[model samples]
Target chain A: MTQVIVTVMPKQGVLDPQGQAVAGALGQLGFDGVGEVRIGKRIELSIAGDDPAGQARAMCEQLLANALIEDYTVEVGA
Target chain B: MSTTVAVLRFPGTLDHDSAVRAVEGLGATAVEAWHADAALPAGTDAVLLPGGFSYGDHLRCGAIASRAPIMGAVRRHAEAGGRVVGICNGFQVLCEAGLLPGALRRNSTLSFVCRQMELEVADDETPWTPGLETGAVISIPIKNNEGAWYGDAGTARVVLRYRDNLLGSTDAVAGVANAAGNVMGLMPHPEEACDALLGSTDGQIVLAGLIA
Candidate 1:
């Protein structure tokens, strides 16, 4: 069966306070060149075909990724 | 009146038993509501968003589960000041559902917190909290990875208060009542504690109050 996977991350222009906090702490620990950090999730699903990928993407866009807060990418997996 | 309670189950909930136990122990007829379903059975006086890794907490805690079909009903129920609640991850759902304000951020200490904590009910007005005094101390189990409650200063002040506890100085908010004064979302597990077998039997009173 074909599988579809969706990856979601905090959208650009969103406040990733947690990621920012981590970057700040890293700088305090003497690390350099770490400009940005963002958190995201990876989800894999087993579905039938490309049609389901569209369905799954719609689900991600409407429900999974808060477009105002997050971005998402959908891909097909083996 | 003898009331009806519904426990919402989505794609990724754990701890289903104890939640049902809490409802049954409280004397409410218990039923399970699926996330894919929209309408609640007629006469469900209260709804329980039991704790779990619901929808795997995608996008943020409770963010995903809040979009389930049942959540729309939850939001509407709460809008009418119906009794709806969340515990732990469920609390996160309540926030995401907009039944309440504020959000559950990652623990400030960056750790999963699990401990017996004292709770003082802020107000007795909410049906969910009638059994506890405005500042009564009740112990319940706490377990969550992202249970830190946060919001703006004004919002935080209004949303939560530190309560005086004989057990310790717990913030006035062991739990919170939404604006409508019916919906509640808290971080502790009254379900787990409803039986002496789990810990304190005091949880029964808390659950009982909701069905009251």
Candidate 2:
């Protein structure tokens, strides 16, 4: 069994309000040098297959991430 | 023959009833189509994807519902130049389904906005806005958590513009149509505003376009 992990993030230049709010909170807490914060989601799937990474990529392309506003990376292991 | 409009009902759709009511009020027959169904009702002249948190808004606002079984038929319908209108969450689904241009993202303010807003009819040539005049202002209510629209529409027509840039949409776009002009998606609840009792009858001016 291979574990595929997909990380999806708001594409650069897209407005990520939730990430900005978190960065604002960090700034208020005196965490200096926080340049930019963009939030995203991670999806993990357990697959029993020879090409789990390829399957995960196909899933990302089809439904897991929207190409219009988001970019995703898939990694396989374990 | 009276036009028949198919109002798609996804599992979590909240505004299907209002859409049906608005369609019936426009003197059109309203048929309810299910998300899991593989086809729309026969003789459907138009398709309406009403607002709601479909699939519990999982993955993204409309990500899951966009691939619902009935969407294949909707896509075919749009390809044949059938009129399709998506309101609020429906707009998100349209964008996700690639039937419309641009993507609706989380509101820039990161808040669920629910308010009556004025929209300027930027273009009145699409099937969804034939009853409106270019530059006319209409009152519609917008309610959603992820209603901010992103991306350049390129050749698609910008049919509606927010009068006050309420949700940080690019160029204050409230509604838009595909390049072919048969499909439209907007971030307002026109169905909810279809009656004078609901504080506005202006929505009828929009929905009435579906009947023909």
Candidate 3:
């Protein structure tokens, strides 16, 4: 069995209002040194596989992330 | 032959009734096609992807719904030069499905914009805007959380422009037609604007262009 972790985030130069709102809230709560916070999602999958990396990459491209405004990274581990 | 437009229904799709009503009001037959179904109704002259939070907007708005089985039929339909129109969330799905260019992202204001807006007809020759004169402004309701239109400037022919530049869309684009001019996706609810009771019939001109 292997674990695949996928991370998805909006591509640079695309507006991310949710991330901005969270950054604003963080500032309101007295957090410091947060410059341009960008938010994204992480998905973890457990699979019994011959090639989990390939499967994970296909998932990200076909379903997990939208290539138009988002970029995704997939990491497979034992 | 009379036109029949298929209105695709995904789980959580909220505006099917109004979309069907608008199409029917235009004297065409409107049929509801389920998301899981692999085919649209026979004789589907056009397809209308109505607005709503499909799959509860999971993954991303329109991401999950874009993979539905009926989309295969949509792709083939468009390939055969059939007309397709997507409104609001439907616009998001079309982008995700790759039937149209660009992706709709969160509004710059970080708030759901729900109001009547004026859109200039940037391209009057599209399948959904023949009656509209170039540069003519039409009023309609636009409501969405992730309605910002983004795309490559050279690839997208701006079909409409907002009077006040709502949502910070690139080039004030309110809508766009595919390079073939057969498919269009826009951020406004032209269906909800099809009646005098809605305080405007400007959307009729757009919808009427579909069947004409």
Candidate 4:
């Protein structure tokens, strides 16, 4: 059985104003080295059956995210 | 024919009553339901998730409120083919609940937009829009901080598009229906346009069409 985890968020070039606002605030905190920061969703799933990783990734693609504005990544179990 | 409907007014949700009157105006008995309340009052037939920022647009539009209690009942109702309409912010909530596909984000222009736009009646099979003639152009008010429609090119074509050879789209999607065709979410405010003084009462047809 392969467990999987996924993360979803907007693409960098698509313009994330909320993320930019946070980055601006961070600059005020004396964090000069931080170039950019974007916010996204981190989802973890615990699967007890076979090919859990595949199922999780499919979920991310089919419904868990919008591919145009957001990109997603899946992590398979060791 | 007495139909009871529940209009959900989540915190920050501003257009609950307009939805209520729209339903009542169509001859349905309507009432206001809270987000925290777990159970809907008896005799409730349909549920309308009205517009507004349920959690101050925090986390994401409709994100935090997706976990609201009455949503459970709404989910159950949808599973049984009960009618549900999400307008503007209400559309955001339905997407967050996984009742609809894709997500609404800030417009590509990155501005809080308030305007009247035309929507081609994409599908006429659904209960919420039986009054439309599948390709009819209807006018409604659309106002929101985040109302972008995003998804892949393929899903945009089949699932969202009204038809080929048409070009009035922000993302080729102003509204979307679930696979079951009972639940629908629209970024436009049909209620606002249901009165003659509002300039166009085209929305009343769709609202009244959902009578069941």
Candidate 5:
């Protein structure tokens, strides 16, 4: 079985209200030097395939992420 | 002939009844369609994606629901020129489904806004707003946490605009129509305002726009 991790984050130009709210809370807690924060989702998948990267890409494009507003990266586990 | 509007019910959908009643009240037939079903009800003239947290809003609001098997039918339907309207959460689904442009980011206020809002008619020729004159302002209920409409709206026409930019949407767009004018997605709940009990029948004008 091949394990892969997919990370989906909003595109640079998209507004991320939730991330902004979290960043605000971090500032209130006195976290210094935090410049920008963007929110995103991560999905881990285990599949039986020789090309886990291909499967991961399909998942992200078809269901795991909205390409219109999000960018995704996939990592394969050894 | 009476038109039949398919009211889709996803697992987390909570407002299908209002959509049904709104269509029936206008003398059209309302058929219940399921998200798991790969096909729409036979002879469905239009489809209404109602409000609710589909799939418990996992990943993102409307993200999962947009991939439902039934959306295939919806895409085919829209491609063939069938009318479709997504309201509130439904609007999010349409955007996620790629039937419309943009994403509905969390509201700038970070609160679930639930109240009556005034929408100015930006386009008067779409499937869901033809009954109203351009620049006509109508009252309807706006409710949702991720209600801020984002995206360029592409070549699709803007059908409605919030009078005050309540959710900080780009261009203050409250609703948009496909370039073909058959599919629409809006943040406001026009179905919820179709009766006097909801404090306005002005919404009937919007729904009737589909059938008329």
Candidate 6:
């Protein structure tokens, strides 16, 4: 079984209210030197395949992430 | 022959009945369609996807519902020039389905907004807004947590604009039509504003374009 991790982040220039809220809260909590903070999601998948990373990319294109508003990265683990 | 409008009902849809009634009140025959069904009813002239938390909004609002089997028919119908309108959550589904341009993001306020808002008829060329004159302003209720429309409308026609930009949508866009002008996705609840008792008959003006 191959394990894959997919990380999806809001595309640059897109408004991310949730991420902004988190950044604001961090500032309130006394965190310093934090530049623009953006938030995203991660998904882990276990599949029985030799090309799990390719499969994960296909999944991101089809359903895991919206290309218009998000960018995704895939990582494979043995 | 009276126009036949199909109102689609996905699990968790909250406004299918209201959409159906509004369509019927506008002199169109409204039929209920199911999400799992692969085809719309025979002789359907237009389609309406109503609002709600379909599939409990899992994996993102409208992401799962946009892939429902019935969407195949909806896409074919729209491609063939049939009128299609997606309201509120329905709008999100249309965006996700790639039938419409752009995506809806969380409102800038990070809170759900529910109230009547004013919209200007930005373009009267689409099949969904012919009843109103371009530049005309109408009041409709908008209720959603993720109602801020983003991305460039591109070649799509901007059909409506928010008078106040309450949701921080790009260009204050309230509604938009596909390049072909047959498919539309709007954030407001036009179905809920179809009667005076509902505080506005302005919605009827927008919906009447489906049959007119």
Restricting to chain A, the TM-score for each candidate equals: 0.79, 0.95, 0.92, 0.85, 0.94, 0.94
lDDT of 1 by residue, A8-33 (tens): 88667545667877988999999998
Model 5 residue B170 lDDT? 85
lDDT of 5 by residue, A1-78 (tens): 888999999999888887888999999999977878998988989988789899999988888888877999999997
lDDT-sorted candidate list, best first: 6, 2, 3, 5, 4, 1
Q: Tens-digit lDDT track for model 3 on B1-212? A: 67999999999999999999999998999999999999999888999999999999998889999999999999999999998999998999998999888888888888999999999998877867776689898999999988888888577867888998879888878898888888888999999898898989989888875795
- Summarize candidate 2's per-residue lDDT along B1-212 as a digit string, tens digits: 89999999998999998898899998899999999999999889999999999999999998899999999999999999898999988999999999999999888888999999999999877766665689989999999989888879556589899999879998899999899888889998889888888899888877876776
For model 1, the superposed segments whose C-alpha errors exceed 4 Å read A1-78, B153-173
Pitting candidate 1 against candidate 6, the one with the higher DockQ is: 6
- Which TM-score value belongs to model 6? 0.97
Model 2 TM-score, all chains together: 0.97
lDDT of 4 at B10: 82
Q: Write the per-residue lDDT of candidate 2 for residues A4-78, one digit (tens) a residue.
A: 899999999888999999999999999998989999999999988788999999999999999989999998877
Candidate 2 regions with alpha-carbon error over 4 angstroms:
none
Report the C-alpha lDDT of model 4 over A1-78, residue by residue, as the tens digit: 455778888887766767877888899999999888888888877776777877887777655666646888988866
User: What iRMS does model 4 reach?
Assistant: 4.7
In model 5, pairs of residues that clash are: none
Off by over 4 Å in 3: none
For model 3 chain B, give the 10-residue run with minimal summed lDDT: B124-133
TM-score of the B chain in model 1?
A: 0.87
Q: How close is candidate 5 to the true structure, as a TM-score?
A: 0.95
Give the per-residue lDDT digits (tens) of candidate 6, residues B44-109. Answer: 999999999999988889999999999999999999988899999999999999999988889999
| All candidates: TM-score | 0.73, 0.97, 0.96, 0.74, 0.95, 0.97
Ranking of candidates on TM-score, top first: 2, 6, 3, 5, 4, 1
Could you give candidate 4's per-residue lDDT for residues B3-53 as a string of tens digits? 888899888988887888778777888888888988877777888888888
